[model samples]
Target: MAKKQTKDQALANNRRASFNYLIGETYEAGIQLTGTEIKSVRLGQITIGDAYVTIRNGQAYLNNANISPYKQGNQFNSDPLRRRKLLLHKREIAALDEAVMQGGKTIVPLRVYLVKGFAKILIAIGTGKKNYDKRQTIKERDMQRELGKNLKNYH
Candidate 1:
């Protein structure tokens, strides 16, 4: 018999975010999406690789996140690259705003997933990584992969 799978699952992940930045604190923010957009998300038609979070007018906005147009949406589908609003508390927005103001720090989306039928994004404070830092990340990742392979062979 097949077991029922959990409805909560990741729709998109920013794999490059970790390689490109030094991540700090993280927060979960709700995303405001249209009906078609939500439909596309549930189908895993989303990309958040180059997406980032920004604060303006005391509100947080998600930029560069692409939610592809639904196949049957036709004219009902909105722009795939349109800026989406992120729902967060005033204090949370203020904290993110303050972190950005500290200079050299920015907010980036780590991943997007569904929670109770609603889309939620995991955002974090990040500082840009230097070229050398990126190289170190690559080295560490390779080492981890090699170690995992060795352990499997040992077993």
Candidate 2:
């Protein structure tokens, strides 16, 4: 039998999530995807930059995530921006709901990756940062870069 190759890597990343919000705790959850959607995702044609998690009727759903239709899916392709259900434990869902309602935190998708031929998403609880906080982060990053360069010159 031929050995099957497994590609364990992130298909899409929300790089702006860190810059825009202070992420607290993270949870890994499985995503329910259609046939065409999964095929498109495997081809690296998904975007989660503006995606967020919301709880409805005790179930968690991913909103605003775009998974482009598979090129060869023909008429079986689903809507690109359709809300997808997230597979998380009941306890986890309750915890996230409590955090959002009481703690004033938001759920954001950090990244989407493939593990063991299944799609998984890393979700986090985050609080939005103020304008000054963003500026401070940029300033600190620049300073760190400069310091690293200065230290390299001394070696």
Assess candidate 2 and give its lDDT.
Answer: 0.93
Question: Candidates' lDDT values, in order?
Answer: 0.92, 0.93
Write model 2 residue lDDT over 1-155, tens digit each, in one string: 73332444679999999999999999999999999899898788999999999999999999999999899999999999999999999999999999999866899999998887788899999999999999999999999999999999989
Tens-digit lDDT string for candidate 1 (1-107): 63322434678989899989999999999999999999998888999998998899999999999999999999999999999999999999999999999999999
Using lDDT as the measure, the top candidate is 2
Q: Following a full C-alpha superposition, what root-mean-square deviation does model 1 have from the true structure?
A: 2.3
The TM-score of predicted model 2 comes to: 0.92
Query: Candidate 2: where is the Cα deviation over 4 Å?
Result: 1-8
| Model 2 RMSD in angstroms | 2.3
